[model samples]
Target: MNTTPISSRLHIAIFGRRNAGKSSLINALTNQEVALVSDVAGTTTDPVSKAMEILPIGPVVIIDTAGLDDTGELGELRVKKTYEVLNRTDLAILVIDGTIGLSEFEENVLKIIRDKNIPVIGVINKKDLSQYSEEDKRKWEEKLKLELIEVSALKKHGIETLKMMLIKKAPYDDRELSIVGDLIKPGDFVVLVIPIDKAAPKGRLILPQQQTIRDILDNDAMAIVTKEHELKETLQNLGKKPSLVITDSQAFLKVSADTPKDIPLTSFSILFARYKGDLEELVRGVKAIKKLKPGDKVLIAEGCTHHRQSDDIGKVKIPRWIRQIVGGDIQFDWSSGITFPDNLEEYSLIVHCGACMLNRREMMYRISYAKSKNIPIVNYGVLIAYVQGLMPRAIEMFPLAKMIYEEE
Candidate 1:
């Protein structure tokens, strides 16, 4: 359970003003000192996350953020970070002090949560010291329009009820989506082409590759993993033709030539674009490449930060390819990890990574945010396929996406 990746767990965030027992509540919920507790107003200066298996809730990532009402310059920065956590939050716990009740700060936070369309449970902590009356609860219920759960985090009172509320209100489905399993039938063989370059981890495959193989096995299909150099040999030695050939985006050119054109070919990034984000929307976004101007700015966003190798795709190879395709000077900007620029109007196009390190909610949030701003957003795989003149072939297996691209 502890080995589960953070991206695979449900993200639950705790939000409130200072000294509202937010940290204490987390301790009580987990029944461990997972969070630092102190009497200081601004004890938790940054967001602290813990991935644990909660009974009834299964795997979950509980994030404890800074107080929403923090003051001073540093405190304001902390508050900003707190709000950013909402992007990936699957469920929220608005911890309000029972004695103080809901103030302007709490109301503002609630409004932001509602704006994000995140499911929430209003928690009135410190119930032992200041028990909230039924009338108080009714007023809050009417105003907030959400179910309220009263608890004393210090004494562990009502903790079980709070756990039950979390189980009931969690915004997740029991049926999980597949990466590529649903695309093939049982007993079919899928070949995975992974390029072991400098960007590749020293001793293991990346998350997307690992998850894809697991999904294939779960569907009772065979997965053949090989490096780009060995792909031809692997295919030639196979007793039967493979159902599909999926390659790393960087090795698409070589892999496409080596594999038979009759078989469907795609990249791991493209698969994640559909599983984690909107495939049709990304397919449409690829059109922006053809409309690029000399001075237009393109934003390349990555979900995780790592040391850039000499031939790094996002930093080196992608820019070179864009320049080659556009045939002129183009401005480029880069962002990695949770930090995304708010002023996106300057960028004519946004190209994002596969987002294997980010949860589905966070990936969708980035895509939807770009769409709301009228910005064209494409994924790394889709853009690579388009630039390589293989867009039609890359999406051949996904008929709807191919149709949309053709219509556009």
Candidate 2:
């Protein structure tokens, strides 16, 4: 929300070994001494991030990572932290010392990035002094199948070209908005039930609700917003029946009962799961609820900060509901805002909230991480449906999965 907007920002990560001029490259690119440059090895321990408006590309986060070949226990920890940044990175600049070319450490990092399917631009730094032969560059290019760019970070050369290349490489738009636009035809009515409770912010509407209305308007459809208490009267006063009703997951039972079963009904969280995350995985994650045993651990991950709701959904309602459904003791672990643990092997299942604030790459990375470790992940709506004995009705939006669930 600052002058440098986060919207549509490309996350550029710079990785290399100690004294590979990674820090100096960052300084040269930004046209300022943005990072600490030193001849000493392992100067940058933690990942340093800066946001700038690079023309053509617009806003972007430039990350300077620690040396991959760092030594000792602290060095290993730093390297581990650097790898974690890759999850959010959209583009990578692998800076290698021109004299030495590609080493085993650099190759290992490249392999990991390639495994994640992220694009990489190889930067041969210290071009001012090192006589890195053309033969070396050509041979490495042919071998690695990567175009090597010569850059003198000390003299600030090839910085503009790097920016241009990044813009050309990074994705144009990094968001998902399918259901809100596709479901309602032009001029059709869509009722959105938003509960104005303690959880409701002081003056602003939550992200999902605001985005839903915007998408409806974008599609030339009408969106009417009202609290839970007013929903019955609001529906009654309407001249025509709404094409669909979307409510908060917490208010699903009452809203479902109030709205006619004939009209299609779903929750904002469910729509968000489909829009910004993998709906099928979440639909499957709900199955873990049935398998919950006594003293099982469930991780509740929320993208936004927790609010002062009477029934704080993630902390209170979700745990309470799970216990009732499982009819046993279930321990809950909570994570809020921008942080998610690197290790997720401990939890039996992970129940995440609709990640409207996060980008697709980040969401998929989390999903992929859990899935690789064979841990199930579900979102608010799907989890609530399983709790409320309406798993079939709630997931009716996804036909194949509903059919599969029916068969199961």
* TM-score, one value per model: 0.96, 0.88
lDDT of 2 by residue, 1-408 (tens): 234324235788899899999999998887778889999999999889777777666778888999989989999999888888888788899988986777777778888889888999988888887877899889877777888888889988887777777777776543534657767799899999998877788798887788788888989999999888888999999989998899988888888888887778888888878776788887877887788798989999987675546668888888998889889999889987656886688899999988876656677888888999899999888888777876677767678668756666
Indicate the TM-score of model 2.
0.88
Judge candidate 1 at residue 217 and give its lDDT: 94
Superposition TM-score, candidate 1 onto the true structure: 0.96
Off by over 4 Å in 1: 173-175
The lDDT leader among the candidates is 1
- Candidate 1 has its poorest 10 consecutive residues by lDDT at 169-178
